[model samples]
Target: MRLGTRGPHNPSYVWRSLQSTKELIKKGARKRIGSGCQTKIWGDPWLPDQVNPCIESVCSQGLESSTVSSLRSAVDGSWDIDIIQDLFSERDQRLILSIPLSRQECDDNWMWANERFGVYSVKSGYNLQTNVSDTSPNSPSINWKFVWRLGIPAKVRNFIWRVLSSCLPTMQAFLTLRVEVNNCCPICHNLPEDDFHALVSCPWARSVWNISSIGSYFNSSCTFADWWINITHRRNQNDVELATAILWCLWQNRNDVVWNGKCKSATAIFDSAQTLYSQWKMTRKLHSPQINTEQQTMQERWIKPPE
Candidate 1:
């Protein structure tokens, strides 16, 4: 289908929607042609629908003079092999030769190749998007690489992501869900047990940060996510890693207080984070693929997004 250009007033919205529609059509549409007049033998997707973009062959330098109409005789929809052999590779020629011509005498039309009976529906469109996001083999977010590839255990990485994303079941989150729970910080009882209160602003959490080297970074102009973004953007891998470990340790100690009312002191929290970081370093040294362990330590580890 022909798509309209962007509107003058909301050009970005129009352009982005138009571009995404083009991508969907490129992924989902295929031709059903009565005659070969409208399809290109080279650039267009007139081939069979097994491939996503039904064009099966690439001619990087460009194809020799060819068109789908050039593959058939005018009087009858029969293959004319001479031109096909001259322009296409043997495999492409065979692939083209395999396609049966339409007998219904209909005009060329496009249909969704991914849907049953070649029909499109809003449900089908939604399902196509759902597949792209969750079920497709290649759909994992590149952002996840920063979380999953950390040198900590898988559970720890997941917990770190929850805290960063504010997905943790902090007391404030429970209240937002309308679940019956106390709002005050269970450890300090000074504020709502929101992510910031539980992780950074509570008296207990503040003491943990104060004892840590990152205490200098704990300032007034910071939200939990602002601090997290700042930590992730720093050029030093050591700082990123240390921040991760410290946050993880802080959250763990907070849980200890909330669940058991017995948690580590600020000094003990810092010491635990240091111990975790050191063990990770020593373990990497033990399993080093390089001949020099020091070289691996010098190598950058964090795969942060460009600022």
Candidate 2:
């Protein structure tokens, strides 16, 4: 159960798959201190804090191998405030003192930090994975409200969400996943095809944007998420919808270049976006239920005649 335990030299496929879960286990497991003899204060993750379950303070010269037991008083079996105050930083001292010890003697054990019952479950693991994916340090802060509220198709909104969240399978995304593929933009053959480059910075994409109505919103923002947020904040809902539609079409064109080796003119791309936007708007208008004011008034006046 230790973090450093290695797998067999020739492991089976099941064993390999099981070994892949070590990191997830390491992230969620912490030592539930009992006697504190078995848990190393500096090495083991015994702290209760979710942000950092392990000790953040540097180990003193002679305290490298010190156990949690050393910080406890011999007589009362409580935390030694004087030793903790001297040996650790203010934050570590506070954290160490906050953990309550068991009244009776017991052996130290590992517990799932995410669960109240100290047991691991598949649901908790899945949630941990999802949270990690969504809140990665490398990801930009996206205005999800703006994305989902845009007057565009649900699929297009989802597409924009993927782009903003760095979920799209761009060339750089493939590289990050260790997939062997050319990282250059398939459309422009210039920079590495990342979210920003694929959607905004590629020559083909830029051409389409330059000819579009919302081109003025494009600026020197580093990421597509930033650019989207900036433009949506300043522009109206119609402009946001147009911009989203154009980006979606541009992505389709890029895919055509990547998969079918076909590229469209900038005007063609822009026209496709406009067509898509207008058609969606018209479709919404047609499908939306229109209330007849006269009929509604008649019904209201004649309501509950018998019942």
Candidate 3:
């Protein structure tokens, strides 16, 4: 007999209805060529009779179905209801318990549940749950030297790098040690130290950095030494100006905030630094005759942008 054929005694109503559905969905022509007309034909196991875009609803329902299938596959008598109840939270277990069961179906359901949702199973060597002790073999390990390569000042960089990478628990460890309470920065009163208050959290410093286009280039791991070294080594004139403006603005802003209680905007800082650096350069050129060639050369070498 041909597959899916109806006996002469029975009506072919089911096949006719399937064909109508295929035609209604424009798949009749495709079906005539032997193409399967099911959502699962495209390898999507999760596509329901209707598609739902509400993520939470899909996740909760999908998880329950998968959990049932998992438990049905673990056929050993060693499956423990008591352990499962304890492993999953009350809410999770409640959802699992709600799935219907019969005497014959219980073993299959239990195996599937454990395989799909089981937190622990020794017989199948599949443990679905884990704590910190059992880590994935592919988990990333930290490289201390690669982190150190940023060339931040040793004392400041050590804590800054750790903070940036989430290795340190809190910034207070660095802040409290450095800042003075009486002289605390007006904006961020948490700490009042040169490094902590000046670079990281001060309202004035934050504003200044925010306005400088180069401010976005900064990372907590970057330090004054790192700033100096990279700027000195940079070959491009535009990049050198950008780096110079950032450093100059930061230092000038720090001094202004500390001395005059003035918080210059980032644009103001950038403009002032560029103007000052230009004037300083012009003055040095005019004064070259007053100084020895070696001293003049040293001064020029230190300030000139690296080629």
Output the worst ten-in-a-row residue range by lDDT, candidate 1: 135-144
Candidate 2 minimal-lDDT segment of 10 residues: 298-307
Model 1 per-residue lDDT tens digits across residues 1-307: 2633444553454454465577666667777655776666666666664553345565535544455666787666688888677666766877778888875555667778778898987778755655665555633332445656667756677777776555788989877655679888888887788887777777787787778766634466455665665556653667667767887888888788878988788889889989998887798788877567787579677888899
Ranking by TM-score: 2, 1, 3
**What is the descending lDDT order?**
2, 1, 3
Segments in model 1 whose C-alpha atoms lie over 4 Å from true places: 1-149, 216-221, 291-307
lDDT of each: 0.69, 0.84, 0.41
- Candidates in order, TM-scores: namely 0.48, 0.67, 0.29
| Local accuracy of candidate 3 as per-residue lDDT tens digits, 253-306 | 666665799876766876785675566557557766574678756643456678
Better of 1 and 2 by TM-score: 2
Top TM-score: which candidate number? 2
Task: Give candidate 3's TM-score.
Answer: 0.29
For the record, the alpha-carbon RMSD of candidate 2 to the native fold, in angstroms, is: 6.2
lDDT of 2 by residue, 184-282 (tens): 988778789998888887778888888986774456556777787778778899988998889889889888988899999999999999999999899
Model 3 ranges with Cα > 4 A deviation: 1-185, 188-216, 235-249, 289-307
* Number of backbone collisions per candidate: 0, 0, 10
TM-score of 1: 0.48
